[model samples]
Target: MTNDFRILLKEDMRNDETGERWFQDIEIGSVFFFSVQASTLHDSTPPALLDDVMAYEAFQVTLQIRHGVYNFGKRGAWQHLEDKPWWPLFEAESPVLTVAANLPVATVQQVYEDLVACEKAHPEMTTKKCLRSLSVC
Candidate 1:
């Protein structure tokens, strides 16, 4: 199975109290959501079942910039700063970022840079540690 991902929606949310948007200002607690469309192709499937073999799915990814790390909402995972390979998912030319062109590229780059700095300062934090500290685990 070959899968391709594309951004179906990109939302840069603002702070409810501060009314500050993420793209305009890189805030520590900024949040964003990306609705992705995944297309999977099954090449081994019979020609008669080609249409059924190709499947599409829509999923949402929620990310929040914490004090010194970013959190993946669904998996409750904390991503560190050194992870740059996945950044391509936000770039315009990447397969995963084909849609949502309304978002400025520079703004996305700035967010990435800000996240790197935020995570670099506190590399010890992880999803388990964070949840344990909050007594949520």
Candidate 2:
């Protein structure tokens, strides 16, 4: 009864000539290691506080613990006003993969902590995984 997955990070850059957004860069941010089940994808996984696609889910698995490999960096103070948003990394964009998303990206650690205390706790997860932290020691 294992059906938990990790969230990957995507980077977007706007073209200087065309001013088009692209989702050219996708990096593995943090990952929660759980046994994959066939029903994980089709079944209702944990609801995303943020708008992210569902990777896996299970009735017994509530997202709590996570292991991060790379940092998504701190949240920027960019607002969607008439002002310009601070986006520097562009030339490295894949053009084919990059796209625009102004919403603040949640850190892996933050997401983990949130799910642990989520009101809609999974039946099995609420009793186990949700109580743990990112560390093993």
- How would you encode candidate 2's per-residue C-alpha lDDT over 14-90 as one tens digit per residue? 34444232222221112322111112221223422223334423212222123221112221111111132322311
Query: Against the true structure, whose lDDT is highest?
Result: 1
Error of 1 at 63 (Å): 3.0
Give the TM-score of each candidate. 0.24, 0.16
Model 1 pairs in collision: none
Note the Cα lDDT for every prediction shown: 0.31, 0.25
Question: Which candidate's TM-score is highest?
Answer: 1
On residues 53-109, what C-alpha lDDT tens digit does candidate 1 reach at each position? 123222222234343223444322234322555444443433112232222334343
Model 2: which ten-residue window has the lowest total lDDT? Answer: 73-82
Name the runs in model 2 displaced over 4 angstroms. Answer: 1-14, 29-101, 105-137
